[model samples]
Target: MREVAAAAGVSRQTVSRVLNDHPSIRPDTRERVLAAMAELNFRPNRAARMLTTARSRTIGVLAASASSLFGPASSLDAVENAAREAGYFVTVAHVSGPEVAAVEAALDHLMAQAVEGIVVIAPQQRVQDAMAAVSLQVPSVTLHGAGLAGDDGVFVDQVEGARLATRHLLATGHRRIAHLCGPGDWSETRARRDGFLEEIAAGGEDVTGIVSREGDWTAESGAAIGAELLADPELTAIFSSNDQMALGVLHAAREAGRRVPEDLAVVGFDDIPEAAYFAPPLTTVKQDFAELGRRCVARLVERIEGVGAVGGGGGAGSATGSATDSAAAPVPPQLVVRASA
Candidate 1:
């Protein structure tokens, strides 16, 4: 510290402020100090600082889905980047399933590492319940879970996304719309299913016998279900919970000798990058997973820094309230239309 301070021609206090990202430091002075540190190869002792400040400057991430999933993987990357910018390290624990025991084990691992807070990416209701059951001393936030009252979390509005897809089909004059949903245990599935139903009702369509099927959020499962759904000739359009399922519906449509948008229009959610490049160019809803990650870290850090209340309360942290507050509206999803629908 002394060598860098001398090199930068600044006092030790100014150097410290610059290192801590204090807003009071002048930009020129901050740049000079950073240049001096770079030249001197000065590396701050994180362990010694933790002892002095009683803060590990580390955040934990517990994800129920594998990193390969497009939404979860993108979210995880965003969290890591945001944490790094905020001068904090991240530790990840990927649970194999949403089972209570699995979640508990993942939490235990993160606790052992002494992380300052935790961010759970929960897609399933079971995972959300498990998180509620645990008594956490550290500040925690859930990503993608239903923002029930009294829960600290941030989520993409799955219902709104579903509504967008369904409305698009309706606007295209397709009344006999079918729905392909994910597992019933998932909060997203329920929200999307309800959204589809709500839209159908609002449109005054006679959906007395509309078809609905459940899939495992895999292209293969989608394909299998799609094949079965194609058996019904009355189904003029399909709203899939995700883009992968829409791809399956396309495959089934092809095998059944039905042309897209001519015989059966298909809409999907979560417009993954490849959605635009599909054979028929799928129309899907786009959720900002990266923004969700950034918000999750921001909320968690606010609670850790004592600027925000934990769970169910409002705080002056960022534009978005504390993670646990039900009042905070989730980031909305948008629809990207293409040839398929």
Candidate 2:
């Protein structure tokens, strides 16, 4: 502070005001102080600021070990970037399992860091239930798996994404459509399964019945399920819960000497980067994981700053300056059509 003040010909108090973004500082003075700080490579001490303001300027992220998944990993990156832009640091704690004990341990770790708020990437029903049971005191937001929006949460409308994928198959004249879903414990699995079933029922197809199987959201599980589905010669299309599993279905179809689109059309969720490069290319739903992450940070910061309600009163909106406004409809995932479906 002293070096920047001396270099900019201003008092230390003036430099502090500039650093804190005080509106009282003159425009020219603020510019001069910023320039001096940049030239001197001066950085504010977070510890001193915390002592003065009683704020750690840090946020906590609670997530499962599914960081290897495309959606969760991408969302984490987005949260980190948004937190940095907001002059806050992020601390992430990954729970090794879906049990309540693991969730409590992760929360305890974040609380020890004195985080101002928390964001939970909870895709499983068990994790959500655990979070609800813990009764977190700090302002918190959840990234829900189901499409239902929470007062303090944001989501990508997974049910609608599934509906889009299923409707596409129906439009293509696929009557015997089957669905390959994730584990029943995951909220995403139930929501996607419901959407697929609803759309199939809407078609009024008098086929034998709905053929569904659960997988672990992996290519291997998808391949095994796909192989089983291939035995039903009447099945015309399959909708896997995610892109990774869809890749397995593709491999199984090829191994069974089945032609894609012609013999068995397939659609998957989460248009991962590799989806387009698959053998026949993949038709999948694209979620804005980045936007979801940004919104989580923005909402949590608002709660921490007392500008938004704590817990589940309000703030189920997108971040300010985001592509969508809070008053507008929730962002919907897009279906990227390719040769596979």
| CA error at residue 3 for candidate 1, angstroms | 3.8
Clashing pairs in 2: none
1-341, model 1: which lDDT tens digit per residue? 99999999999999889878899999999999999999999998988778866678999999887677777888888889989877899999988776788888998999898788888887777787887677776777777754544545688888788888988888888878889988898778888888888888888745532646689888888889988888988888989988888898899899899899899999888899999999899999999877787777877877777632323333223324434454457888999999998
Task: Output the worst ten-in-a-row residue range by lDDT, candidate 2.
Answer: 310-319
- Structural similarity to truth (TM-score) of each candidate: 0.89, 0.89
Best of the candidates, lDDT: 2
Q: What is the Å distance of residue 328 in model 1 from its true position? A: 1.7
On a 0 to 1 TM-score scale, where does candidate 2 land against the true structure? 0.89
Name the 10 consecutive residues with the lowest summed lDDT in model 1: 310-319
Candidate 2: where is the Cα deviation over 4 Å?
Answer: 26-28, 149-152, 206-209, 307-329
